[model samples]
Target: MDMRETPGVTPPHPAPDVFGHVGYQLKRAHAALRAAMDQALRAHGLTVPQYSCLEVLAARPGMSNADLARATFVSRQSMNVVLRGLQDAGLLTRPATVETGRARPATLTGEGRRRLRAAQEAVYAIEARLVRAVHEDRLPALLADLDRMARALSD
Candidate 1:
């Protein structure tokens, strides 16, 4: 068979939107949503990563930098950058842990909680709007599908 003359093979169709392809669409949508979220977080003086750190620390108040990196899916080096920024902002403090003299555990300052409360509202508002973009009944299925996709991708 000529390389170009396979009978069962079909030529690719033209597409207008980059997102017309499944992978492209998913990537584009992710970029769009993340950009929106980052902008929202900016208004509260937080970056998405910082907000994420705040949330995880809020939930588990004594996570070491390494533990925080694991929970937030970030590199320890990058986590240090964010942790330093938040600490400098007086939003959090990462002191040597009482349990482990070598590791630093993050504790949210009162200011961190205040900022987190506002950021949480904005984050949920973004979710509410994005969720409402789809049909109400489809939202649950969409979430399940997204969760499955994330799990598959992680694995």
Candidate 2:
């Protein structure tokens, strides 16, 4: 059934206002993506942040906890918690104490890479589903726009 034809159906805001705003829609999309990621990673016994930490560590081994926090866009304290969880799970490892500096460099164990590989399959599938929602020709532009938006907000 068409939403427009339903009785008592109305947008929360006018067409040109909040309901149609880009930032509002983006937030909604982000929420949906986060939920999807959480569900996908759950089967691997990992949270989204844990999966994120694993992914970054896979790409750049020996990253400090602070570096992982920045790459994952979480606070240092939060990253420390994630790291401790991963360590306890035997997925990743860090020194008992910082050898050179205050930062402890983290690296994935063989099990970490194995789990990350499995999780990547599921996460990449979700990403592909989202990409398929848009026109093929617009994918590059859409990605570029997202990058630009992040850069703009960061700056």
Best by lDDT: 2
TM-score per prediction, in order, is 0.79, 0.88
Question: TM-score for model 2?
Answer: 0.88
Against the correct fold, how does model 1 do in TM-score?
0.79
Q: Write candidate 2's Cα lDDT for 13-123 as tens digits.
A: 566556576789999998999999999999999999999999999999999988999999899999999999999999999989975779889999999999999999999
In TM-score terms, which candidate is top? 2
Score candidate 1 by lDDT.
0.87
Local lDDT at 114 for model 1? 97
Off by over 4 Å in 1: 1-18, 97-101
What is the per-residue lDDT of model 1 for residues 11-81, given as tens digits with 9 covering 90 to 100? 35555444465568778877887898899998999988899999999999978889999888799999999
lDDT of each: 0.87, 0.92
